[model samples]
Target: MESELKIVTFNIGKDKFGLDIMKVDAVIEYEEATTLPNTSDYFEGIINYRNEEVLPIINLRKKFRMPDFDDKTLAKVIVLKMDERKVGIMVDDVKNVRSINQDLIDEKPKIGGIRQADFISGIARLEDGMLIVLDIDKLITKEEKIAIDEVVTD
Candidate 1:
């Protein structure tokens, strides 16, 4: 049987990336995060969503070592669920959900010496351009996860 994988596509600067749709909880508008102390630069602090849940926001631009957008009000947040934990990823914009055939995805290229490249699962070739597929679980390091867990509990 041919497998079809669905992904939520988002933009970070000029590059387009995709994450497993199953991991996505929701896509929300940008909200200012309360800065946290002792966290990584990529950590955009925490934000309360719908006045209920507090989610740690990760700035994709910072995480990817890209410059921040001049105007953040236009940005979007993609809420993702990894295991039992939830984290929100801030991006330039939320594109659309796409379904790609397994055959269309090629193995991620070996970028020698770039350890961060490991998070890239595959590259999906589309009519317009290639979409970089990221392994969401691998995006956050163990240390970051521990810090987030600690922050959420506190």
Candidate 2:
């Protein structure tokens, strides 16, 4: 039997990327984060969600070494629960959820100058366009994950 993978797609600048839908907890509006000191540039600090949970937010653009968007542009955050820790990824916009057959996804090619390529698990070829399928677990370094855990736990 052929397996199908559901992915949540989003835009960062003109490029399109996708994450396994199972990893996504919720999509929320972009909110200003409380900046923390001595953290990586990509770490956008933490935000309190509904006064219940504090999630460490990351700027994908900074992480991927992409150019920043205009301040006037509205953004959104994709919340992900990695084990006991919850992290938020800030994106330009949330595109939509899509389901693609596993066979359609191609292995990630060796590419230069794309910082986030290491985190990419595969590339899915869609009728409209190509989607870079990301492995959320590999998105951050071990040290970064530890920092996020500490931030959320505190």
Candidate 3:
């Protein structure tokens, strides 16, 4: 139900954020990611998970124009499947898994610094701070997905 949202909190820079776990399929540690040239900066590369070659996995840092992925700061790829297709998202750090009732989730605030605020499902007011819930499906699209047919692993 939209009212009851199962969220996975993760660090995307200094701010706290949450993603509906329902949209998540799996979380894998950053490894030797295949690189796709001429793709969006956010599109780090493709990952072979469970025998399937998924398209580009977006790095939250790059997606928000933060920083380049480095070996020092390891990240988890939050796998998401939509319309029978799977994709992934990389976060600086995986924080916690929690639940929020519908009332706790509010419309996104007018204040903005990131990209399209509409991609945010809502702001979940947790006990500690506001968790930016992401609209996974809205964050990506068929046209936006970077092709990885020729991606080479390092």
Candidate 4:
């Protein structure tokens, strides 16, 4: 049987990327993240979404071994769901949504230095250019998730 996929397109650094929109609920503005204590460097912490507390997000900067954040770089959050629990994924910005068939995806080139090259599911060449398709479900794990302790609230 043939299957179709819906992808959410976005940018990180200078690169264009996409993940299945099934992995996303909505994209929202970047706000101050409630910082967490003694956690993985990737974890930026948590935020409040419509009364429900959810993880704020991790920046690609920290993920790619760049220095800690400064105030200049603008950002946004990609909201996701874990069962009924809500979470946010921080990205440079949200782009748009697009559809691609399962057969249309091309293989990602084998590369070193960036472990994430392996994390890419496939490269989808669109009318304009290429998009790095990601395996969002494998982006992290439950065991890998660390709780945030927001000072003002907690």
Candidate 5:
């Protein structure tokens, strides 16, 4: 039997990306977040989730240095479970869950001049198009992680 990996697909602009479904908690509609000062540009802000938890929203496009979408653009927030905490990532749109064979995933290439390319774990070939599989754990740098920790703790 082939090893299958489930992933949640989303779009950041025209580029399609996928995250391991195991790491995903939920996919929610985008909501206005309370802006925070002294935070990174990609750090959108925090949003109250289900009146229980405060979720920090990150702009994947900004983090990847991609073109920013306008406020009018429809977006979705993908809640990711990381390090015992939930972090929300804003994407242009949420696609759907897909099951891809582990053998189909190709190692990410060394793409020069692409910011955050290192975060890509591999590239999955789908019938429609290629899907960039992202490794969420490596998405943020150590310095950024420290800053995010400080903000979340406060």
Candidate 6:
């Protein structure tokens, strides 16, 4: 039987990216994050969700080394659960959820010398264009995870 992979699509710069729907917890409107000091450039800081939980938000554009948005009014945050940790990834905009057949997904491409390529899990060949599938867990390094832990604990 052919299985389908459901993904939440979002725009970062001119490219479209996808996250496995299973990892996604919520798609919320972008809210200003409280900037933290002494963190990586991509670490946008933490936000309190409904006064119940605090999530560290990472600016995907900066993390991918893409150009920054002149205005961030249209930005959206994708809340994801990686294991027991919940983090938010900020994107230009949220696209839509799509279910693509597993057969349509190609192996992660061999992009030479691109650091960002390491985080790509695969590429889904949709009728419109290719969607970069991201391995959310691999997106953050061990050190970054420790930093995020510290951010959440402090």
Winning candidate number (TM-score): 1
Off by over 4 Å in 6: none
Better of 2 and 6 by TM-score: 6
- Which pairs of residues clash in candidate 6, taking residues 3 or more apart in a chain or in different chains? none
Q: Against the true structure, what is each candidate's TM-score? A: 0.96, 0.92, 0.84, 0.79, 0.93, 0.95
**Which regions in candidate 5 have their CA more than 4 angstroms from the true location?**
none
Clashing pairs in model 3, backbone N/Cα/C closer than 3 A: none
Name the candidate that leads on lDDT: 1
Off by over 4 Å in 3: 70-73, 112-115, 146-154
Worst 10 residues of 4 by lDDT: 145-154
lDDT string, candidate 2, 1-154, tens digits: 7499999999999899999999999999988889988888888889898798888999998888887657613889999978777789999999999888999999998778766467899999999999989999988767789887776676
lDDT of 6 by residue, 1-154 (tens): 7599889998888899998999998999888889989999999889898788989999988988888767766889999988778899989988899999989899897777775577788999999999999988898877889999997898
State in Å the error of residue 107, model 6: 0.7
Stronger candidate by TM-score (4 vs 5): 5
Please provide, for model 1 over 1-154, each residue's C-alpha lDDT reduced to its tens digit, 9 standing for 90 to 100. Answer: 7589989999998899999999999999998899998889999999987787889999989988999878888999999998778899999998999889989899998778777777799999999999999999889878889999898879
* Cα lDDT computed for each candidate against the true fold: 0.90, 0.87, 0.74, 0.71, 0.87, 0.88
lDDT of 1 at 80: 93
Q: Model 2: runs farther than 4 Å from truth? A: 112-116
Off by over 4 Å in 4: 1-3, 66-73, 113-118, 146-154
Report the poorest 10 consecutive residues by lDDT, candidate 5.
65-74
| Residue 37, candidate 6: alpha-carbon lDDT | 92
